[model samples]
Target: MADALSQFEHSIYIGSYMSGILYGINLVMYFLTLQGLLRKTNHNSPKSRRFFAIYSTILLLLITIDVAVNAVWGELMWIEGRNGPGGVPGFIATQTAAWYQTMGSTAVVIMIFMGDALLLYRLFVIYGSKYIVIAFPVLAYLAGLSLAIIELVIAGKPGGNFFHGKSINFGTPYYTITISLNIIITLLIVSRLLKLGKAVSRALGRDSAKMYTSVAAMLVESAAPYSAVGVMFLIPYAMGNPIAISFGQVWAKIACLAPQLIVLRVVTGRAWGREVITQAQSNVEFLSNGRPVVHASGIELQSHGTTTLGDAATEKWNSSTKSLGSS
Candidate 1:
């Protein structure tokens, strides 16, 4: 049993390290895509660029710091056991390392909070600021935050052991709340897109309607991975399994990359606007002077009209749900 437990811990450590590497790779992808967008096109205004830059940079920094903390703590607790605090002759069996509980868990919680908040903002924008639509998510967010604080306090207590003690109770439910929050937010966003797609389908045609559904699919593709990973993280831990951090450690990367992928897609002009249809789809031959034209019951819609940078920024930051293709 002891040997099995040791192997389980080892596996979790390896998994966490592997996930950290994946996070680094995704971070590079995000940077490269953002660079290409800014260099190749003027779709994002200066202010918009600044906002994205700040947001991306902060996430990168958080991941970097968290990974570093995990690396150092793993080395101290697992590797150079005789040279560290947990090395006091079988104390490792009795007491979990403090760093994983305090600093490591805190980093994980912070990343989860940021990711959820950003998704919440996106949902708010897409739903045309209907507070009622976001009421449940907002409540979940608050509850999650409160539980996270409780976890932090428990983990930070003098000589507290998060994984093997009563503190694990707080951590488990915290993960549950985070998972539930993400699921709720994801469903809300997807439902909105579906409704929008049906409306667009009625206005335009069957073919054009697929784009909106595609958007919904895109959202699910982005949002689902991290939530799934969060569930992976929670289940093992709740069952007193040692390999839970394998899933927990990598979710930060997924959460950060998902929204950036959407932004990158929109800026690249392959999605997010009707012009993509004019360029990519041949059947949407409704083009006037090389611009996509939309006819909704004989009402002409100019889908490619230029909006000022200020207008674009306003639409994004002010959370306006006005359709760019309509009027």
Candidate 2:
């Protein structure tokens, strides 16, 4: 039991250290994302900008509260409560259902939910808003949400422990379903982007297709790191390992970071939005002269005896190329 207590304390200490680093990184990224969204030169609609601004702000606040709560809990466990009852381990055991701990757990849940919701929204948009494609995912998300709620309720009860008894029973399945959802959605989004990239390549050249097919674009669009961290946490967690907490801490921060990265792309006019497919399919035309013409964002590209593109098209194309190149 002493050894176990030591392991738990070490796990929390390491997890907290990593969480702090991630939170700092997240803070920097949040500000950058916000700046991009609010830039006057950004072409996204005001409504879109406003929505993302609020979305990012809420995520920031939740993560801030989460980090702060964890810090307080750590102090209480290692210092204030260390000499009470049976020492630090006993204090932890007794306070498993404490309000601060519950709040931290709740913040993590909200972050996961928001991340999964964003993934679903991206999947919906990528598939051209076809509700049929997302029917099962939506059901799975709802089920996960229900389980999370139940698990939280169980953990918040008197003498409750998050990693034991009924709490673990519900928590295991809740995490399994939610993490599985992220993995499935990431694969789907990446598959769709790859397919579209192939078609764009054939029509508009590899350079143009790079915008959709690039590694960075796929990583951001699919939130691959978020899914990766979830898998890392879920595996050990399911096996009842103490180290799971460390991965879980990183997973929570990545949940926020992933969406912020996507939002940054969106605000910069580089993300694959709802109109990407439509624009790719409808914008390319073959003239009677056997020359290809491309239209994008109201700008025209004509391949005469010599290829010529309008200023707006050239600028947009150049910007995309630069973004991909830098990435």
Best by lDDT: 2
lDDT of each: 0.60, 0.81
- Clashes in model 1: which pairs? none
Candidate 1 residues 137-205, lDDT tens each?
Answer: 888888889988987887677666666576788877877888988877777767666655544443345
- Cα lDDT, model 1, residue 142: 88
Per-prediction TM-score to the true structure, in the order listed: 0.73, 0.87
- 291, model 1: CA deviation in Å? 26
Clash number for each model: 0, 0
- Displacement of residue 191 (Cα, Å) in model 1 is 2.3
lDDT string, candidate 2, 23-131, tens digits: 9988998898878866667766667777888989999999998899989989998999978998887888899899888998999899889988988988988888899
| Model 2 steric clash pairs | none
